[model samples]
Target: MPKRILEMTAIEVARLREDGDHSVGGVSGLYLQIIGASRCWMLRYTHLGKRKRMGLGIYPTISLAVARDSARAAAALVQTGIDPKRAREDEREAARMHDAKQLTFKQAGEAFIKEHEPGWKNLKHIDQWKNTLATYAYPKIGKLLLSQIDQAYVLQVISPIWSTKTETASRMRGRIEQILDWATVHGHRSGVNPARWRGQLEYLLPNPDKVAPIEHHEAVPYEDLPQVYKQLCAIKGQAARALRFVIFTAGRSGEVRGMKWQEVDLFRAVWTIPGERMKSGREHRVVLPPQAVEFLRNQPRRKDREDLVFPSPRGTFLSDSTLSKLMRDHKINGVPHGFRSTFRDWAGETTHHPRDAIELCIAHVIDNKTEAAYRRGDMIKKRVAIMKDWADYATSETTNPA
Candidate 1:
């Protein structure tokens, strides 16, 4: 037996009260249930000789008319052997998938770095990527969804700094472009990257060099080397010796900082810097003059497995800035790397050594790849003479025991 049907009205629906369901007859089997303070609608019916209930919504939110309409629809689905509960769950899952596809720019940037950071050559590059995003791009559009980013948003990140801090802005633009491309490839985003330069951003921003010119490192004048050499030899301690060796060897500060005792062969009189440590990614053989070899043999020995030729006080490879500070403290205007320039000038002007031999001494990649490929020998005989002469001239002004 069942109650006869009339359209359920708002007043009759509000009067619903009981410990269980109160039938509000309109669409068949529709019930208004009260449990404590909560009131909701449900459709009750039998299907396949089994009774089931499906929630329509809460009271006040789903009015009597709306509840009846929804219950009738659920009843229709049940009549056709469809489960409303499972259908609702499927609908919720689809909504979640849509939200996930709208990944924010910051989220995409972090994912990009995670995928690529392991392959990057230096830890500093990771720091650079994170720092640039935090300072520029993150504030501008990081919260926006990946698909929301456009050329206008990219301009917002880069335009202000493009002219004033050109180098930093250029790096940030490249980083943003890379992150967008990564997102697009992964299907989190689509279409051309707004940060791209070749066809898109290039038309928007001015050339970087036009805004800020590349500046060469300042060098010590070749004629002033005698006095500078004298002053350098007078300083005491391991850092001073390291600085002198950096100049004498014409090595990059990074190479000198990480120099190992094993890399030097005193008997052979050459320092073999491996490809991994060199910027050129090729093993370079620097022929040590007699003075250079004598200086190295006299250095304090260590018992550690990887004994550093010039270790810091903490027994680690010395900090690259250690030599820079040494020069500043001594009131020399030239940087440690500027010594290579001084060596080049001296080689070009004073020595009769072949240009390629001089280039090899300083580890420059010779322009003629064919010649470089064919030449197996490092011209040890000629290089030996040139190195000896350069060493002699450098030390000619300073004979004081250091």
Candidate 2:
């Protein structure tokens, strides 16, 4: 048993500030430690043959009376074989967990976004996350505690939109699941994620693909493409000319719209689209036919806007809707993008082009892992022949008699 020092008054304890541990104690091993003008209450004790120290509280926030009481209680626990420091740590961790449980869904979501935003590559994706959460989730479950968010709350946000806006609803459910998963990992919540899609949400909601069958872009039939191409050439303006270029290359509208003069090599008859501009995140080379190379050579140079090959009137990249509007005005049945499908249909139905070369013309991702691993080359030489046939067919007045 440790000896108890004589109990001192508050005034005596305050006066003994010689920068060392002083027992101004009513309890054994209770101390008022002073070092370099810093004063704190420390309880010094032994448990199971090991000496230990525990910070009771800081003074003058914790007075002498309160310090003695804390020390006495801690010493009692020490006598019962409990390490006082470990007991204090356990209590504090429990309190922290309880506090974390009270965090609202919105708070947790914002924290998750903030933590991950730096690593995210796309700004549009970030905007979509913020927009969807604010529009659907915030009104429903944002204010609810993170730990309290269950299947019922997730269903409330997703059910109303599931059948009507299946795509958005599916994405929102995924985002909610990720946020909840992040919270669980950080100890803010527990249990299976209610927004998870597999065995959980699968039973709760209808399958997304079944609810909203994919509607492919409206494409002009291959037989009707010759007439459509003739009408497109008759129309004047940069947008019309750009549409012609799209038909010649069978490239995406965004890819054509954002095409730069630097990317085009008229001498070599090739267009090299940088990975950043391409959807696949890999650089792609487009084989330009003689007609397409001639068209490029004839294009007027804009000295002030030298970088872009197809800059809009304001000298910026053309809006996505620009070509679509041109088609609408000309009473064209299909979208500008649907031209790729037109080319694919024509080549598959009429020509002897290989399926792989035709698909690569439009930059479609190779799905088969084994095939993708083996096929490293872009087959630019094969596509050169394919593009020539496409351009000749597009410009010729004679339609396929078959």
Candidate 3:
């Protein structure tokens, strides 16, 4: 007859070993042992003629009933010819692979920049891409795994700003597409880049061009030129003086604001705006009108500064936005830049000057290469006459009858 073995506590099991019961052969059939040191039950079994062991946890953590139940489950797997050890190892490997596949959109974006930033034309181009992505895309999708990204999430990022800030949204979408493309090619993700527009997101979102149509360039009408010019002249401020200088010289805001005392020759009645300052990167000379000359002469001279005629409050070069804001503050609607168009309109309508002379006065490239190559003269005489007329028209009374 087989002898029955009672369940043992951790203390009883330790005492059994201490009593030197070496001939206790029936204990082998008992599948559970209580480790005295840890006060935990362990299950021992044999599968395919090989011995195996599994922990059933501590006394308090795994109750006696639960331990026996768990041991029966492990035994069932053994009887079915499965190795629980190998199954656990496979699960761990799968988890690791899943982690590796998960990468955030921000991570992909940084990788994209690293790969293609070197091919960019210049540092400014690279900075533009980085700034746009950081400002718009990163906040929304930065934490989401690359594979998890979809069109809805991308739309969420862009739609809020799309109508009001079309240009920024357009550039942001392009940057996101570039990053997702990089992720797809590198095997971090698979599928159409969510940022793509052609077939993917085209129907979902409003067309940017339709949603935000371009407003016509703001310019004062040619007929209202004299009255507007008079108003501009009557205004007395640094900004007004700067505007008058820009109109008188027919130069861009940058060129006029960047002017220096050394660039001017008061005796010669000329201001030589350098090639770098000119939009065409070719040096151009302006014959200063008597009003422009007097305006410059009356300006309080700085004792030490070499460059920058229109300095800010700290005496550095004025920001490019300064003039635009000044116009806004004064409620001068139409394009502040439309002043250039106004000048062009006045030149065409009021004078018999050649097209090339007007274009040259505005620093626009004379498109006819043959004429450009052959025409060496600067058309100074005609330009001088044009400048005088502009000054007269800007400062004089309205010619139109009320």
| TM-score against truth, every candidate | 0.68, 0.78, 0.53
Candidate 1 regions off by >4 Å?
Answer: 1-103, 119-121, 181-192, 304-306, 368-385, 400-402
Ranking by TM-score: 2, 1, 3
Report lDDT per candidate: 0.85, 0.87, 0.72
List, residue by residue over 1-402, the lDDT tens digit for candidate 1.
543245556886787666678888888889888898899888887777778888889998988899989988888888799777667789899988878788899999999999997666556678999999988988989999998999999999999999999999999989999999888888888888899999888888889888898767778888888778889888887788887787778888888878898899999999999887787778989888888888887889787756888888878877767788888998998888898898899999987889999998899988999998999888878888888887777787888523
Candidate 3 structure quality by residue, lDDT tens digits, 75-153: 6777799865565568789988878967898888888888887555345568988888788888988999998899988
How well does candidate 1 match the true structure, expressed as C-alpha RMSD?
6.0
Worst 10 residues of 2 by lDDT: 393-402
TM-score of 3: 0.53
Sliding window of 10 residues with minimal summed lDDT for model 1? 1-10
Shift in Å, residue 218, candidate 1: 1.4
Where does model 3 exceed 4 Å of error?
1-130, 138-161, 171-207, 278-282, 319-322, 325-331, 367-378, 398-402
In model 3, how large is the Cα lDDT of residue 329? 74
